[model samples]
Target: MADPLPTSLPQDTAPPPPGIGQLFLGFLSVAVVAFGGVLPIARRALVERHRWLTPDEFTELVGLAQFLPGPNIVNLSVIVGARFRGIPGALAAFLGLTAVPAVGVVLAGMVFSRYGDVTAVADMLAGLAAAAAGLVLAMAARMAEPLWRRPQAHAILIALLAFVGIVATPVSLPVLMLTLGPVSILLAWWAQRGRP
Candidate 1:
């Protein structure tokens, strides 16, 4: 007799593709609330809340976005939108992601121009910056969870080296990418060579 099929198959099924309106509203919500960075919010809404992408899928999308030139989250939105509904969806998601934030930034600039010297405004801005930093740190920790769970020494080594190169030393991003990108790829290939 053949072996029994896995009972957890349903959990692996992909979610339904979202409509254009859903894409727009989802991105719009993420943009409005993500003060310092949109990535974490985007991940939460798309992966956790909307069930649009799995965590591993989201990580892959983020990787692709990082490899591209533009803002990572914006690039991700374009990729996701296009994947779901084509060019129109891409436009809708991009616009929804940027429009209100653009207007809010302009209005904030106007307010700052008027109240640039106000002590209260300065204090509020400082607090916002601190909160933004905390958000970024939290996002970093969350992103690292998968890696930590898998625990590949080479991957962790590369990550640490990249962090130290970028943050502690004067090595620029382009330089590090050029140096480490091929190395990582080669290591991955080598590791998988003996596998089935």
Candidate 2:
């Protein structure tokens, strides 16, 4: 008789790392499909569809990307690409993510310059803005879901503190990052040290 099928695959059997072409095409598809915000779709593609990064990994990279100089998603693409195949991968992903969008923006600018005053154009822009906000919220919830499932109270506390500090108080982003970023890192280190 044939051996019974295994219930679970071994940890060593993780999916093979994606090629540079795959990275380029993946980000290209994300750019094409995402209407108002690319991050939500990017997260879905990277974490769920491609399985290129886990939810926690995506959250961590995005967190780091936010503190970088340029746009967060751009930085994320570069980082993700570099993590896999160094500079070439980064270049491919960056081009795929920005090439189409950059052209679209130029065309859109010309159209808006001509018809910007039209009521329909204004309404459409407003609707796009609202949709962008909703996409951001949805992405936030998905990123937080993994943290909620895990026992990471310190991380949650830090998140809440950052939220309150930004919304309720006058602290700026730099101040919060400088102060709380190290604290969170230390707490994470402490938590990890307890493990075997």
Query: Largest lDDT belongs to which candidate?
Result: 2
Clash tally, candidates in order: 0, 0
Highest TM-score scorer: 2
Writing each residue's lDDT as its tens digit, candidate 2 over 1-196 gives 9999999877546577989999999999999998888899999999888889988899999999987778899999999999999999999999989999999999999999999999999999999999999999998888788777985878988889988998999888888888898899998999889889
**CA deviation > 4 Å runs, candidate 1:** 1-13
lDDT of 1 by residue, 1-196 (tens): 9999987648657678999998999899999888987888999999888889888788878877877778888999999899899998999899889999999999999999999899999999999999889888888888888788888766787789888998998987878878887887788787788569
| lDDT by candidate, in order shown | 0.87, 0.90
Question: Candidate 2, after superposition: displacement of residue 93 in Å?
Answer: 0.7
| TM, every model | 0.88, 0.89
Candidate 2, run of 10 with poorest lDDT: 9-18
lDDT of 2 at 17: 91
